[model samples]
Target: MPGHAGERLILTGPLRLVPGTTEQILSRLADLGRTVSTEDGVTDGLSVLALSVDDVVLCLPTVIMDGRPRRWPSATVDRRIDLTSYAFAEPDLISAYAPELIEHLNVGHADQMRQLARHARPAETEGDIAGVQVSGLDRYGLDLWRVDSAGAEQVRVAFRQPLVEPRSLGRELRRLLDQSANTSE
Candidate 1:
């Protein structure tokens, strides 16, 4: 979700490797409009470096593999993703209301959460499941956190189409729930 810092793609890593003062680096990066692209490769990966807005060096090393995801010596891979172009995302009503919406869905619509999760990952719904909650959301989808006997995982349930109007959120959500129920039946 977009915050006050701006639209940032959060990459999981230790802050130590983020060069310069973390706050300064992030602020500078936000000011300069840029996007990062990665290629699928093995141990012999390419490191993409670019000059920051403040003239600092930004080293972005990417490692994406093909086929079944396996534990790499230096990195962890849970799944494979396609190389697609990302459109510029501006902060919208969805981002602004995510916290309240997430809380509402989790507290008042737990059953719907289960329905959406089950529709998204039916195999994972079987047996003694512990809980399901809406962890996040955007115009396109809801991010669900599911916990069961196996463990916990986040699943993204995308809407049939991208939401264009903030006022249509309720209608879109109802459509998703209805679709899920129909699919199960």
Candidate 2:
């Protein structure tokens, strides 16, 4: 997952050390427009260097066995690094690496979600399941805000079948509303 700065670049598993000095590796990363930084840490039985650039963080891992750098069998590097805090702040960088994320965060999805919210029906229950408001919607599912006496509860409902078209979403909403109505009765 070596995408742009804003997009997620997920690297999993062990990484084989490149045939070069530490300085050389760092230089290579710099050439790729990354601001390289080193931390004294071990990740997945390997010496890890934290690389940061344009608000993106990546791990440069080296294989170390028996207190020495050893050659790995495979060239692939895999390690779990949590980058939830990192964000793509630059639009140009995001477009270069992960254009799909840009598309997802676009106005079109917001508009669709707005439309879905307008069409959402009230729940028939008198308890916590008060009014059913479609708060957010994506290709996968819809997020619902179940307004109640206590507070607004968030509920996400994934479609049982993949919605191939926009019209299908309306049908699914109707079905969910009907099911809720029946359950309340």
Candidate 3:
């Protein structure tokens, strides 16, 4: 595969609770590599990125470290997340959006990841979900965006609640992205 340039998208607002340690997060990210197909998953490895909760920012290609209330940009988002505010929603959006990636999955690449990230953080824009400020999202949450290599975008729910249970939503999104190709053509 040839090297490709990437894009930068971010998720702003409030962060959720991180479940693990930074060391563990780094190690897991390293092991997971860039492609989800190559990753073993958090069950066997580490959520690495999951550790972030209230301060977590799920950008494309990689995860970001939360700044202490003064992260260059604003503290929370007005309505939608933004770059620099959190980081890229689909850190992989760039590579996935490559012209070559056009045939990679049935679903659209960069756009798909953005869609999922938005859906993952669905909560009270009032800045409170499950008693916490819904700041950012991670892989575990952005599932709706996932579509097979060739599938079409078929979003079901427009909004989500609880925010936590929906964390599992990422699985469904991934499945969709992985199967999107099959569904499209």
Candidate 4:
């Protein structure tokens, strides 16, 4: 069950307004290699920044908290994705990017309502606001979420679940790289 777990972690929490907290987070994220290629660039939180941040290129878990869950934790909002997801992706960026799996949930489906809260894939978000389609290779693209600032906050982080396992992707990538190198020589 461990290997088959849906996703691994849900890294979403409000940035407590403390001294230097923002700079610390931004500085650390900045060190994570931002620019990967001419076509791919990563950034801190906006699309027009010029510099880009590369997706961690990690295989992990994803957590999704539906805004319209049959029950409300405190407020009454329907057809909306709650704090964690938005707080994770917006103020971020808006563009078409190739998505990578960052956070994941141990499982994705459930049998009961309460079980859903316990079971389901955890969605981890960071860096930017984007969308991810769980299955399919070359699966489409990353769509940036539009945040209009309504006294609240929002974020968009896209985590795509690859059709193949991470191990297999490694092998295939290695094979391709090797082939390319051989041809170059």
Candidate 5:
């Protein structure tokens, strides 16, 4: 927290769709005692709000307003919130606080990702017969490794619907296993 009051903090993560106009966003910031100013032109292909608190500045990315649902097109944002991803208009401020800020964000993001993966059930058995191990996961689905008498084979299991969270992936895997069992019978 100790840095140039002019140092900027940018939120580079996906924002939840808030149903409101741009003025509403400014008003909300005002309610939080942050006096933010908006720049309409291109900054990383998105309009952003600039805020200065003490010596540090904060930039927030705004959603593209296209008269559609405010939600992001993807079910989940794969990228982590990284402070280094932000560009500092002031070059002098970059060497001062960017490293510390990026390290903090990286630590937090790693912990959160580890927790999500921990909740993931990597291996599952189907009625004491077929067994599968989840090798990886993505927004689309699971990377499964099936083990059988023939041998172990890698399989990609895509979800019919985009998965928003690891828990949903678990449920989808169960559903797929059930469907597979029913078919085999």
Candidate 6:
């Protein structure tokens, strides 16, 4: 709080952790008579920032709207957020190497992306399928970028269950791909 003026501060993380956390921070800010602005939305393609405070690891997404960098809305993230004082320090394996994973998926697996895109929504996948790419990956799911003659759209494809470790990412993704392929046949 040293460099922060408490002006228009935006706190974002997993939705479960943010609201309660914001309440606590707001309480402190109220003591100083400061004001803040907060917004919420559902998105999975935002950039992530990992924060390690004490023993807790928080992976927060950052969004850029209207060509300006902005903090992601508080409602974007996987479930299960702790509210107590430094409850768990468990590592977020997915977030740790998301950039590399996303890059690999996008560059190496275009056909699979198209297959996975089949599960997005009938409307979303109805256009003249131009291209598909994996834009974001989290423990809960994958956010796909689908471009068609009409335009570009974002699609969310969730895992069967929340992934607990990095080793399962490939398995979950494979399961999704296989399921999608089978559905199309």
TM of each candidate vs. truth: 0.51, 0.31, 0.17, 0.17, 0.30, 0.55
Candidate 3 overall lDDT versus native: 0.37
Whose TM-score is greatest here? 6
lDDT of each: 0.64, 0.49, 0.37, 0.30, 0.45, 0.67
167 Cα displacement, candidate 2 (Å)? 1.3
| Candidate achieving higher TM-score, 2 or 4 | 2
Q: What's the lDDT of the predicted structure labeled candidate 5?
A: 0.45
Q: Give one digit per residue, the lDDT tens place, for model 1 in 28-146.
A: 66678743333653323323334322112222223446853432344322232222322234547877777887888899989878877878888666765588988878889989988
**Stretches of candidate 1 exceeding 4 Å from the true structure:** 1-91
Residue 131, model 4, lDDT: 27
lDDT score of residue 38 within candidate 6:
39
Native-to-model Cα distance after best TM-score fit, residue 169 in candidate 2, in Å: 0.8
Per-residue lDDT value at 138 in model 5: 52
> What's the count of clashing pairs in each model shown?
0, 9, 44, 32, 4, 0
Highest-lDDT candidate? 6
Worst ten in a row by lDDT for model 6: 1-10
Per residue, candidate 4 scores C-alpha lDDT tens digits across 53-73 of 222122233334675323323
- Cα deviation of 44 in candidate 4 (Å)? 41
lDDT of 3 at 179: 52
Off by over 4 Å in 3: 1-110, 113-166
